[model samples]
Target: MRYIRSIYIFCSIVTSVRSGASELPEERELTTNFSSMSLTKVPEGLTPITTTLDLSYNLLFQLQHSDFRSLSKLKVLILCHNRIQELDIKTFEFNKELSYLDVSNNRLKSVTWFSLAGLRHLDLSFNDFDTLPISVETGNMSHLETLGLSGAKIQKSDFQKIAHLQLNTVLLGLRTLSHYEEGSLPILNTTRLHIVLPVNTNFWVLLHDGIKTSKILEVINIDQKSQFTSYESQQIPILENAKTSILLLNKVDLSWDDLFLIFQLVWHTSVEYFQIQHVTFGGKVYLDHNSFDYSNTVMRTIKLEHVHFRIFNIPQESIYLLFTKMDIENLTISDAQMPHMLFPMYPTRFQYLNFANNILTDDVFKKSIQLPHLKTLILKDNKLETLSLVSHFASNTSLRHLDLSENLLQHENDENCLWPETLVTMNLSFNKFADSVFGCLPRNIQILDLNSNKIQTVPKAITHLTSLRELNLAFNFLTDLPGCSHFRRLLVLNVEMNLILSSSLDFFQSCQEVKTLNAGRNPFRCTCELRDFIQLGKYSEGMMVGWSDSYICEYPLNLKGTQLKDVHLPEISCN
Candidate 1:
């Protein structure tokens, strides 16, 4: 069905380019309004155009083969920010002089020979290419030098085809590269390749293959698991003198075995930067240890950003000593179970230490992690069950953005926990809180994620959240909401999967500042009152509530998977 539309759109663009209606010599169209415009017209005697055409942000639906029939002099074509779906060399027959082509930000499914034949640089990013290409012959792109196939789905087979392409260089996105199968990377011909993979043994195989193929190449920029590869292999003789940086993306995939493997790999090399991320793994990942030189490890920088470890009873002082000689900056040890002594006893070189996730029970805060140069203390997500630890960092005066989400905190009276004061972004979601808990947070909080908790209603006392810009309360037990017109600065309100009924539509309408609303998966009754809710959801900037098609009718009008925004209210005459 869509194939016909794309073909029609392509015919229109080609006719316009050949007719020379603002189409340049270099195929670059910018901010042109071509929305809902028909491409069926084949302008008369239109010819003689060349080099660089920009057809972006034109609300174009599709690109067909007949569009480029008259663009014989075209070189570079920029079709980003359009609605192009498919591409083929048949579309480029008019542009016989084509070189570079950018078809990113479209809805392409795959890359094939028919689409690319005559170019050097091609940008096919931000499309849907889930698997590697089926065609692998290589003559499709003969003169191509630099290709940007980043963010596309290129499988092992496609990679093998690319390797066979014998191109010298390319830039790819890591997010796209991580989706590769466990053990199927294509064979390579380049001397060096920027490979991104999880910290698994297969990555080792890829590195081994690259080493065997490209020995004279420079620079091996690796992610978290790359740290382990640097230490475990004798291949360092091949890449030793080359400048290397192993970025440890925190918490994505770090097992105990992988951690020690990475440490051992980095122990002897001049590798720089060990970064941690925000994803959490099991506590068992940090249990293993490999031997390293306690005295001579000379790597310069060590950053533990967003690392979650569970070392309750182990002697962590040695881990601290490992980084004594290095200059550490953003040290974030978040969402972990750590002992009290993980902090440095004396003023050290680190500038920030974010121990945001821990079991901060009594006696945990008696002393501080004395990082005199420490400027920000993010203790968010810690089960601060009690408020005793709050006073520990109060003296620091530099702490900002304290998040205490998902904590089983209770007040001094041992009943319910309240929000903290003077923080930038306080995340009190998924916690047991009293009605007065909102009073504890100062008016300085800018962001709050109060989702997934036992709160049954929105308090009218929310005037204090005037500084708040984002609030998330999805998956709660709330059935009703109080007036929220006071939150002038609020931009996002996520209340998906709640017990919101038709009566809550008025409450949502009052908050005019809201730009995004998530009301999907809620028990919303399709009553006449719900009609207004549906209407507001359709018209409001909030996502789910803005559309009748987006709003899933949970009750009397049970639309299991309908988009409420796209639904028509007249068709659903709720009784």
Candidate 2:
């Protein structure tokens, strides 16, 4: 499964290279990343042409003007997670082109303003500033587009300096906030506002003010103390004036009524995306049909992660009814310890549903009805042991992408498997499948991931999958690569961490259409056949990933631990 992730990342890099979005050779060489080096002072002999420098997570306590004076082309500088106590105003005077600067998570009490007129993004969060470092009189920050501020206390006067700046984002980390003046956040003119609320504070005032002007609001760490009480009337007007399109709540505790109030509040607003994580719902309330009788919400997607229902005995049908009434097109509820999901009574507008990392079984679909519009269903990390039950459920829907990875599924020889005709991509990795698994697969599947399985061989009968493009068979017991004759259109193949001893020339000749191959981590015999395979990878250019590092010799005493790229063999030995 790790190799599968690497393959996808490699494909994305290839796509970026083709689109000319990747950095050029010269630009790549000008980047320096010295993070976590544990240095007390900046390294000497810094490249004069350096355009980006990262010195984060170090022991340095101070910065001098001479440290970065030579790097005149520096555009981005990161010094976060350091012990820096102060910065000299002339620290960045030489780097006139600098546009991004991060000095977060430092011990700085104050920083004498530098000539940062070119800076577009500045981060000073987690510092020792009681008030914001930037002031309205500091004309040097006129071009700033983003700002990060944090302190023990915040008041209306703290934001009076930057209220005129039309910014894109404002990140306020007030986890230790001991005091917050009302109407302080609404003074900022920003499109996105992210606030890490204090555990014990007046959260309603902060939320009410933050949501009034921002287009996207993200609030985190609201505990039980901040849960809705007798403030429903005040909260409704705040939500009604919300211009936010996305609202994210994290680490919040609420009751059933409070949760429903939030749903109803956001339904009439312009919010289209609502996500909640690490939330706990308390109260022993049983909801009925009338609870969800409101009109359809404007929300298109709703995601919940690591949420718990404490002391709540609500029926599963009622929970399903709540979401069905919202008319959400995409929904995800993973890592919530869900046991089963009964079929919804009414049709839902859900086009994508992810229910991973739960204990759901085949019975989840036993009473299921046709979901005509569902295009993607992710049931990974579940207790589904039967594959036919899922196939039957999907055949009646419009599912195109299905992920059943990290489950207890295995092939049953007696039962024939039939998949949806619309299904094109499927991930069955990290399961208990064997060689017989191929015969039951979807014939029209374009991308098949069967990695981390118990398969030993690719039967010749798999040739029926002519439409296959990408196949992952890593972490298996296969002795050799599967023949491309079985998948004529295959472009990417992963056979890493297997029991192969040698690579035959027949594989290279037959798999000419394969543009990317990951056949590393195999105990290869250092023979003429292996030598030819190494030569093929050398000349193919980007066709073989993790080449020398993942490809090492493990056979024949003298050649042990030698990389395939360094293996030597005379022409006479091969001929």
Candidate 3:
């Protein structure tokens, strides 16, 4: 779900860049993110050279014409999740360089658009618009490539005005739609279409029309009703030459048969990436073995999140049937409450399997599940308590990345754990690990995250992981900073929020290869050792992050609450 939001934001930026603005240097673009600030009006003292301004999650009710008079170079403006009701035509007259504007989740009913000739991406979804906000007769939206509209009673005439405009993407928020005319969506010419279906609307009609023009179709169902009987009379449209290659369904409810019907619909089309989130499966807990065959389907990825079974106990047979037959290269079933994994009886070509946030234990591997081509396995937030079994189990497969974070993992014994030699990255954070965790880790591991554990110290006797590059040991109980005598190649080290009183210059000298270090939020003693550490940080630029707020002194009564950057000491103080 977080990735979905990131994709949306990334697409918004990409669309803005493709709308005629040349790519600017990373250092030249100044960005200000004021999201969730609870501001009622535009803040004062905004930089005039700012290129991106994010004011989302605020309480702004109106926008005055002089609000953005100083921002002449602003290209991206996000004012979503506000209470703005109206926009004066000249509100953005001074911001001629603005290319992307998002005012979604606002109370806007009408917008007078006169000065936004250069605007390329405009999102007005979740507003009170009953029809298209722009007037075809006078609006200057010729440069627009992306348009978002929602919470309206859409009619055939609504899109007739913009029928001639070829758009890159059309985002329709029909969750709050009052009425929708059949065949009203196909009139718009777009390469991608994203729609949020209302609970009671005829979604089939919208899907039938939307797939005709869109190469990528994303349909989100806000309805939680257990049955799809309302739209059963309408035949599910199938297109032999459908242009849609990507399909996404969110918050959908269906029975096993209805779910297969959806698969059957996409089987004939060109959908390659199919994703379903928060989907509930009802009816009997049975799946026909014959229907599970997807031999000719071109689907490459099938991701399911928060999948619920109406029955209390999941049918193991159904799970085996579906997973063994999907033939997809990547399968993700996170947060599905699955207790076990049963692989296909035959060899599988699965490259990635994510079963995170479930109740899987060590016993799941006892059956010798055959996933010979598995490369990445994410089992984070499960009920596993030991790593030896999982390590030895993956040693048989081609596993490379394993995430066992947020579990009850611990070094059950002193036996050295034998991990797959192919493993490169491992995440064991938020567990019950102690000093014994080192003996069980892979020797050749590169990236390791062991934060929020019970480890008190990094024992010098432990075997060093020479291949390690990035190590996160934050939120641990360590009293002293771990020296890089073990990880000489370490590039990034985070040991913040520890119980250290002071840092030694010897540690910095030992870990000279570290380019990034997060050793803040410690109770420093403000002594000569601390003074030398702070001086080293001052000279080595970009090494110590959060120096001002994170590296505050908490001892030596006079230096309490003072930042380490502000602390100064004389040479004779230690003598």
Candidate 4:
């Protein structure tokens, strides 16, 4: 037995040595819990290493040229959340193998080009960089791919230099600034720059410059929130500068006057996708008939969604040019009041019409619904008391996604409005529903918002909605929930302000697919009912982990205005 044991130990040792020799020896992945640790210059005992270092969340103030000389084969160096004031250019030079270097959340005032020649993915976001050093040239970095400089104060000159490079694919961030110089767009000859401009900066000059220089400039995204500072100006300079056929102008909140002026400029620009949003009328402030004329300009493809109109008095000539001359699809008009006569009688090519929150009754909708190829009809808050207008769209086979929220919906005519099984989303919130009236629902009701109603109990038949993903039942008097056990596909369930007991906690523990459970403002008995909540909070991917300080004990604990983690439930008693 002793001889056999010795042979076994010798064999084990031989196997271990052979395994270690066969392994491809490489440096270990650097990982340290330095988020709450104090440090100065790197960490101790990490010299002569070839590993990726993570010195984040350290209160490091300065790093000299020789601080990182030990990490010869380092690939990724993350120095984020540090108090770094200055970085030497020579410290990061000649590291050809280094790829990702994240120095975000630093106090860096400037970064020279010599410091970034070897990096491929650079993240210098949340830094206090105000100006670009002229020495830093994009042409020198021949292998750069992604560059993130968000929250850094940058000018248009920085973009112009980057555009001169031969980079075909890159990410440029310029989302924080008050102004940009004209002609600052990078002119890429062969590569496309995915530029993320500021949400409010107007890049009208950049678009024009691209059309003049870049032969491969294919996409331009001008969707941001900016009030028209210069109103009633000829758009010759903006429209004449379009090198790309696919242009997207999303959420351009121009005044009625500015919107018309821009429309006149881009009428014949041959843009395949043109979107305008938050458009409001000029309050009869400027009534010029020549400005609304469409004999000279025509939009072939346009989409006007969420256009706000305060003034209902649309002129006849303006309506004629918009509905008759222009070709549009997916036209959404929300939170606006238009005159009854302004409705289009015969549109040449319009596919979708969403007149949500308008001054149009059922009688007026019947007269104005005149699209031969209309696909979807969204008539929300037109004071619809019955389903009479739905008869007009029942035969229109293409109609889908009917939203009738915040309207008077009676329980008697639910069957009249239920037809096409292709309807995906139907919002019937803030309405009166009779008992067992939801049985005539379409098959594809994925998202249902039934908040702010007098429905006391949830009917068990609602579990038949197998495709429901999000169900909002807040602000109701629902004392019990029975059908939710079968709702396996529900992702978000909001049942706030309900009467729930401590025993009801076990019902939600096995909801495998439920990610968010908003049960705030409910009268929940403390005791062991909170045991499940406290236990489930430990799960990294479950509810209560994402919330900060919203959960409060209302009934048994009576500990209001306290965070869930800080609630001392031992003091809470049900007696």
Candidate 5:
């Protein structure tokens, strides 16, 4: 019953509009939004014009000839997001101007490309054309720039398809077969290709081809979406594939032993960027001190985000010993809901370090890691209690950015003065500061985020940041900012989601240089005291209060929920 009514309502609206509007012009594109309409064919007498035709999100099962009798000049045809299974070659012959066609997200078994002589871009992905063969002389798709066949079962029989098409970017599904003739990969002569493999893929045999013709391959993205897992391989291949830069192992579930093997392989691969996050451990991995032969170890950038970094039975001493073996320039290791783990004391050449989403406390950094080249250190969502341990970096002059947000840090002593003198940005959000201030920070600190804290009053310590560029004090309990009078160089300030009234916007008077100001999402009093501030935020271009025109009034029962920007408040007379 509901289905019939929906179709009736849709037809009613479309027919009503179609009867009054002019015919779909020959030069204009047509978009028929029949989403969830259970449509099987194009509607009768709806001859939309050429250049483009979109029939996305429909229940189309097949495409026939008469469906496009009117679109002779159609260049781009999108039949995606439909249930199309069979497409007739005669169906597309009606339109000779076709250049780009998308038939993805369907159930196509085989498609004929002979009619599309001028196609430049073709997407046939997410289909079930498992064993498709290609033609030699008849079909000329030599002008195609991009051809995507992701999630299609591409076998050796389908290798003929690549032999003909002239594509710059060819995206294919994973292949695990062990054999490939020397001339088999001539099809990838001058194209960039990306192949997905499982985390446990035995890369030795699979890499022989890529290493032989390194320039032919581009990226080797290892993901967890595949069903195959190979654990017996030990050697990791490093190809002269100059285009292969990133080795991302996202959500790789491996045993502790496999993890070590993967790390060793990556270390030997010399790939510039390597990241392994959301790793699941299968068992314990024991490593002797002799495991790391750091004789010719190059300092590589590595990030390990085992948010569940401890599914194995291992001691912190072993972890630190193994991790510090490399000359790490940038390192990130984090875990959730674990006991406090110590930072590696050895990575002295570090530059960017992200230790966020862990169980690290302030005392963990009591002994500095001697990284004079370190620039950024992220410690957000941790268990830091105080800034007392910041003194450990007293000798460091290169450390710049430090993040301590979402921690247990409290304002006790002026220990923030001990932060590195070269520091630029700091995040101290979501702590237990109410009315207390922080005047002990370094003068060079520019960007500060004190958002989501219980700050009822603006900490007078903020004015000490004379070189501050941006400040975010959002989602607090501040009725007003009496301490913002000193922000001269501040460019951005977001104080949204607070208990702020409109009359207290006098802080903007001091922020003459502030470019972006977000004071929305607060309960406004709707009295005449808010006219200047509301008007300035809604009308003025310099101080962009985000969504200032859409905010609503919360007080005065008569005007409750009224859009604050729409309301015109009278100016109050001082007399």
Candidate 6:
């Protein structure tokens, strides 16, 4: 579905460019990248037909009222990462088509919300505004959907005004609810609300008062784990609207009864996307698996990170039973030391599973490996040494991305040990493997990372990987290009910091589709042949032979420190 949308966008952009109505040559669609220049004003000569202008990373303390008046066709304007303290009234009035404005990370004490003809998204986060300038009256921002207020100490009244807009998404500050007034949360129609309440307050009181839970479908609560303390413990009855909300709790302290209490108060919120991460608890945390049952629920995703289920001291089967009922579309349980070996003989609805940083071994993986709809799997930083291809993953053609980096899969090489070879992206970096490690690599991988493996030579197995597009063999013991003429669609080739004394340009010329090749920091013999191979652009009749200008000579004392791009001379020819 995403690929189709990308194709649609590509076709639309191509049509727009060909028709000349989108970015006309006369429009000069983009100009002035005075970013991080510390300028005090908008760059000059910004044409009227300019559709996109960036004035970010500057020291402009104030925007002139008529600064953007001339750029009437401007649709996207970036003023983020600046020290702008003020925005003059009517500053963006004339840019009728301006739809996106980012003024984040600035010194905006207060902004007079005026007319921006077609404003749809506004990011004013990390500013100095304590009060919002939202008006109850319908203004040009009627179409505004996304409003970011993170790092801004929003005043209670100002927050009420901002809530009246019925925005689709709102990002509040870290401590937005610290001084929560009982009824500060206005009757908003926000579909998604993300905020972190400080630990010092009665969070239950704020949750009960500020928010009208009916309008919220997704809630992200981030607070320090130290802020949580065991309060009254009880099992509250579930509400009828149990499945309407998706909850995300990040870096929050969990009281024994807190999770159950939140589910009770929100009626399980009919949660479809539930993620609890970075949870902190003292001593052993108990889990009543009975409290979590999604058989009759529409649970889509369940991610539990750093929440010690091992400390529960529960039965291994009991832990598996907790996830048995969930028809999870995406599941991530990291650092919990889950007994994957105890998995049931049932398939999950999961399309994505990230069980990284666990005590997964060959035996555990064989018993736990369950995939039918799985597409992207992350098994990084585990103890698995070998993967069974014939008996397991080879049959799962649905898997596309596999990350087995930083694992103990070095000495586990075998003949029938092919991974989901058809995987599009494979990350096998940071593992203990030598030159023989190529036998286990997949064939149809498009993007392959074999960095930091101490590989002395290009894998003879690469000949089988004809579908390779991007290969990262950086920080290895490689000495030369591995005859990449077979990689017809290769785009990026990185072999930096290797032990290569000489490399052939003919190999790259065959893979002409490559646009980026980094062979820097390698010991290249700077002989006559090496000098002739360094030519690019006009030196090679507009052909990109040499990709990096940083490729310097490491041998031949006379030509030692000469850049590959600057070694053009009549004497340094094929002769």
- Global CA lDDT of candidate 5, please? 0.60
lDDT of 3 by residue, 138-190 (tens): 22477888888875687778788788887898888643666778778777878
Cα-based TM-score, every candidate: 0.46, 0.75, 0.71, 0.54, 0.73, 0.63
> Which wins on lDDT, candidate 2 or candidate 5?
2
Instruction: Return the top candidate by lDDT.
Output: 2
lDDT of 1 by residue, 97-123 (tens): 687776655666655456446778666
> Scored by CA lDDT, what does every candidate get?
0.52, 0.77, 0.77, 0.54, 0.60, 0.61
Distance from true location, Cα of 526 in model 6, Å:
1.0
lDDT of 5 by residue, 352-413 (tens): 77778877776566665667787787888888776646544533648788888888876654
Best candidate, TM-score: 2
Clash pairs detected, candidate 5: 200-230
* Ranking of all predicted structures according to TM-score, beginning with the best and ending with the worst: 2, 5, 3, 6, 4, 1
Residue-by-residue lDDT tens digits, candidate 4, 357-396: 7665555545544555555667777666554356445444
User: Where in model 2 is the C-alpha error above 4 Å?
Assistant: 1-135, 138-140, 150-161, 175-184, 232-235, 283-290, 293-296, 502-512, 524-575
Choose 1 or 2, whichever is better by TM-score.
2
lDDT of 6: 0.61
Rank by lDDT (best first):
2, 3, 6, 5, 4, 1
Between candidates 4 and 6, the lDDT winner: 6
Residues 1-109, candidate 2: write the lDDT tens digits. Answer: 0000100011123222221214634544376777779999999999888887878878989898799999998887888788888866568988998988878778877
